[model samples]
Target: MASSNNQQPSPNTHHNPLFDEFRWVIQIRHSLEEDHDDDIGIPVSIFNVPKPLQLSKPEAYVPQLIALGPYHHWRPELYEMERYKLAAARRTQKHFHSIKLPQLVEQFTKLEHKIRAHYHRYLDFSGETLSWMMAVDASFLREFLQVYAVEEEEEGKALRRLSSRMSHLVDYTGRKSAHNVILRDIMMLENQLPLFLLRKIMELQCSSTDAADEKLAKMVTSLLKELSPFKLMENFPCIDVTQHAHLLELLYCVIVPQSDEQTEDNEIEEQNDDAGAPKEGRQSYGNSGHVKQLFNSVWNVGSTLNGAPVRFIRGIIVSRPVKFVVQLPWKILTGLPGFSILKQPVEYVFSLQGGQENTKVSNPLDASVSRPPLVEEIMIPSVTELISSGVKFSPTNGDLTTIAFDVKTVTFHLPTVSLDVNSDVILRNLVAYEASAAMGPLVFTRYTELMNGIIDTEEDVRLLRERGVVLNRMKSDAQVAKLWNGMSRSVRLTRVPFLDKAIEDANKYHDGRWRVKTGRFMKRYVFGSWQVLTFVAAILLLLLTGLQAFCSVYTCSRWFGGVMNNVQKQN
Candidate 1:
């Protein structure tokens, strides 16, 4: 009986799903251990664009024509580019006599775990699948980027002419072409290939590692120069390619190079002092203390004489009693029928002066204690507003770090930027990459935000364009304005102290103008209290009307005359 019971089939004889999961985990652990020694400390550079940013401009972050990495490699829409990618791989293999496509794939497979670590998201594909995808994508990318290579080698020229299928895609003849779309795709954050893979592929074709790296650098520089909106300098800083995770990162390093250890605040202070104040030596003389005191006394006397009348008039105008008298008529008119329509426009004009009140005190300590905490937000006016406030705009040949405000000239110096159809995609992707990487300071992102703040409408764009600060290749000023305005949605609020200082100086210069101050005073004291003033005016009008009615009905003057006569007789 016991033998018969043992012979029965066990209930757990079939395969258990848990065992399969356990084996998979073990395999992954082993792979990780094997590659742990070879880890290059590459962070997850490739990221799915954050949902907020993606929702704002999905086209900027997602691949439109082709997908390079495994993130979007499986999308059916991008799969159509697979055949061309394979062709590129085939042509790339032909360049190297010693290595075949399968050999490249095998090399990539060996480094699969290391490659996977570069991506933030988990790749669901097997090791072999990821290797093949990377190899093909790297080959395609290398072939495409060669079109923009600064120095065209025999291999690049031959490859360009040999592949008829790739000719249309690499043709740089027209402004509008499939080539441009592919260029945009490659710049997308999700559609990036590992730079190491590209270097490996290039190394296979070149004579030596040094030759491969040289060609790769030239190719990347040329690509950046072509795609970057800002002009690249003749002696652009040389960057180590291996340190960067991908092409976008390499491009960012070139554009917003890591700043020095010197803090931005200190640099700004130095610039402000240099631009605004006279040199220290000019104010000093070898034994001239008495002469200095005499000069200062004379200067103070002359200044007082020159400014006394102007200050007296300003004081009278800004005085509360005078403001009330000036506003009384307008307030009364506003309450009348058909005059109510002017109220909103009047209020709006006045609202602009809300923050211009004088808060300074005689005591510095009291002022400091009572002063509001400084807000980190940047609140500079628009370009048109700045220009209207007597601030001038000037285009500069320098980079982003060169932006400055010339206090003497009252000029806002900005780096010249060329705008075209591709500008939007390039700028958006750069900002997206910066946001994702969490790099030290988002210099480029802050630059875009600065532009967005300054350009509020087509008028601002036109002004910038006319000033040569903006080179608009787009069809209309409206489009350029729209492009910049749309970008403000995805950017995080950040304070780049240097840029902020430039803005601060410009605002101070603008606000210091007499016209601006007067306008703010009018808005704050006169127009800002329209409602209360209107109510008072209405009540006064009612009391006057009653007085007139009483006088018309009775002889009020005769009644007061008789009362005065009676009082005089009693006295």
Candidate 2:
């Protein structure tokens, strides 16, 4: 490549083909109409991912659409709730007549307890539990999202009219739960998530047409809010929805490249990703500065068997303001962490060229790196604690009710100091993100004394605050930031062998690292060669022994088990 220039690439133009194709993807995503029981993998709630253009397969583009949104993150969580709701519903309804509401409540409560207990059962000292958890969650959610089609034709017909209405009603209530009767009742009972969903359905059914429309829109918007982790990020306990993003990205890292022809089809892929590839390159120039919905944003670019220009786009529209940084917000991290989060927006303006193939930090538009904490880390804690401290979750039974709250002031903890977002030195090292981000907060804070090789549990990714690693990450940043401020630009942030030192191996990491692909390949070859030699030698020895046996038999010597050397060849 030619020497890089200081010039920055252009942002999204108001309207163009590549940009349009990307817009088309977003439109298709905004229009995803799914059934309440549909098993669309991603939550039907995150939106605005631009579809990718077809460089080679323009024809295939007719039949395929590109979908990129909370495909990894939000979909899985929704899927879990979907799966848990469906399964719990299934289990409860299985032996229907004999089961009473009290029994159902008791059974579901046990299940909720079980799920929590099973989740925390194994905590090893390796940080690789992240990878392991990824595998398990994917499988569990898959099973969870199987979308059990309830067999109630009459009820279904009734639900159809009311379902959309209730959706609107829930939206109208927006964070106003007390006004909604059924929802309030379920919440009071500490009822299952499915119950909450069903209550939401029931409320939608009871809503007025005009009133419900606004409410449902607001309700969908509220759900979409959770798809993003912004509101609760202010007083986060740890990394929020960031892990979910990593999980989804990791899954894409696997599924996107493995596609072949129709033969190996998993059946469900046709219903899911296959339906979403078309709308690439087809966005309308009609609407500008418009806010769109993006629930489970999916983009496909292809024609189905009959060829009706099929483009499947699914996702939720997100209206939440993007907060690119969330951990302690830098200002709270006191010393080092404070310095890391303060970079102005212009810092990341240069590398927008090719973040795709280059997963390299140098790619001006590397979108996969850090942005904010995930749901589990920040939102759940915030919501849960908010209610505990002062926000009330009233789960009532009959006339008597109980409120769940343990009010307390939350402590603010920033994710330690590191390079600012606009830092050019940091963007070029994309591969090292996983390795470095593991300790992102710690290393940024220069807390190595706390991070020495010992891993308390797999989640102990606090290596970012350690001193050695911190000083190491900053050398290049110091020069870049200073240069921008008209200080000396002579300092170079020396690239360290980060990905090389990415892992640790106490009881801390998984065995998969040493057992990587190359090692396995070489091991197979080595075993194959050894097995071949052993086989050949065995055959030769057998032949030689046969000859010896023949002589022994001929000489009337005992052999063959000398089984008398085959009874002396049947003498």
Best by lDDT: 1
Q: Per-residue alpha-carbon lDDT of model 1 for 1-571, expressed as tens digits?
A: 9999999889988875535676578668876677466666668898878787788878888888899999999899999989999998888998985869999899998888789889989886578889999999999999888766734346455555647877767764435468889888988888888899999998999999989998888888778887778773446666566677888888777777576653533211112332343322112112212222333444466556533334544565558875553455555645667455445444433222322333421322122122221222234689998999988999887678879899999999998898877888888888888888854556787787789888889999999999999998899999999998888443443446677668667766776667876786567545786764675588799978876886798766664677788899999
lDDT of 2 by residue, 293-352 (tens): 111111122222221112111111122332222223323322343232212111211111
User: How big is the positional error of residue 40 in model 1, measured in Å on the Cα after superposition?
Assistant: 5.3
Ten contiguous residues with the weakest lDDT in model 2: 288-297
User: Alpha-carbon error at 432 in model 2, in Å?
Assistant: 22
Q: Candidate 1's error at 150, in angstroms? A: 6.3
